[model samples]
Target: MNDLERQSRILGVLTERPFASVRDLQIQVGVSGATIRRDIEKLHEAGRARKVYGGVAALDGLPPRAAALPFFENRDIAVAQKRDIARAAAAIVRDGSLIIVHGGSTCFQFGCEIAHRNVRVFTNSLPLAGYLGEHGTCQLTVGGGDLHREPGILYDTSGAGHTFYAAQFFVGALGISAEGLLEQHPLLVRFTAEMGRLANEIVVLVDSRKFTARPPTVTLPLSRIGRLITDSDLSDEHARMLEDEGVDYIIAPRGGEA
Candidate 1:
């Protein structure tokens, strides 16, 4: 990985878990001890992380100020569910198809699951793009825009200069209710909606817990979503809701269950 990529990974690790040993960072980034140390030094110099005895820690007083949950914070929540959903989503992907994977923790897992597939992927998640650029065999394209550090997303406010399109668009949401797919931020709503328009099909990836969330902004209506892939834990009531909206749904089995 390049210096900028390494530094981003280091900072991402610190964001998820306050402290990380040099050894851990080395293993995760697949770099040498010397390289990890150099990246940590850069982060420390920038006042982004605290360089200590044998590792680095996130800055003490300044927590992320994002209105919505940051990528790191959402990454580990509903881990099993997210993995199962990703597996299901990956199963539906054709080997040579082109798709768009949007930013969010759940979609990040989906991106990783399909990293080695013989397909083309366009993504806006920095972490996902970085991971795929390093490990994926598929063609990868990142959207051009300013970065949203908290969500790890890149979005262009003016929505100009994008001529990309795909057969499918995979995305996650803050919540889903009768109204439609929901998000906590207006930019997310705008950008996600724009991406949906460029795709032939929209697939929603969310854990069952999101059914209970009631975020403020609606990104897309159920009518627009072509399909929904969620964990088996989803209640029959929500399944019926999707049915009522004429949306096809897939229930991904949990760990070890068939």
Candidate 2:
């Protein structure tokens, strides 16, 4: 990785947990110890982190500590359910469509489902980008920004080379209530907002678990959503509420083909 890529990974690593040694960062980032130290100094200068005994520490009020678990760790939960959701979300894409894919475990699975199609995917997730690169035939456009490595998500959309527009936006949220879509990662929220602006269709790829998984912040209001693709397990009460709000949604069956 180059210096910028290495520094981005350092920020990502520290976001999940504190780093006590330069060696730890070297192991996670696979760069020289000297490079790691220089990266730490860069982070310190940027106000993203601070130098301490042995290694770097996440700055206060940065939301790194409050961010959700790493994306791979999240993929282990509700595997079949997530796959079902992904397939349902993928089915909506037409051949040659340009789609914006939001970050999160479920959306990554959605990318897996659409990878072989003759479409293009614009995204801010490095993990999603890498997944598409390895398994997808679809054209991939990864936005430039700091890499949140654990989740492989890119943030700070200002780094993008040009503005983008999409036919569809396949997105996932941390929580959903009458209030709106919720998220723990502030940067991810900003990225999502940008995606929402660039796409005509904002399709939310949330599973049944999110009905009660409320986070402290609202990323997008329910009114802006075009549709919801969720598992069959979504409860009747919440489904009814969606109707009251006029938010269209689709339920992917538990054991059926995606």
TM-score of each: 0.73, 0.72
In candidate 2, residue 86 scores what lDDT? Answer: 86
* Model 1 CA deviation exceeding 4 Å by range: 1-67, 256-258
Score residue 42 of candidate 1 by CA lDDT.
Answer: 92
Per-candidate Cα RMSD to the true structure, in Å, reads: 10.4, 11.4
Best by TM-score: 1
For residues 171-258, could you state the per-residue lDDT of candidate 1 as single tens digits?
A: 9998898899988877778879888998999999998867866778889999999999999889999889888889899999887266
TM-score of 1: 0.73
The prediction achieving the highest lDDT against the true structure is: 1
Residue 130 in candidate 1 has what lDDT?
96
What lDDT would each prediction earn against the true structure? Answer: 0.85, 0.80
- Give the 10-residue window scoring lowest on summed lDDT in candidate 1: 60-69
- Candidate 2 Cα errors over 4 Å, as ranges: 1-67, 157-161
Model 2 lDDT tens row, 1-258: 788898888888876674435767777888888888888898899887878534676776533232365776566556788888888877788998999888888998898998899998898878888888887888999887778787668776465534767899888988888988988877877777777888888999998767766678888899999999899888998899889988999998776563
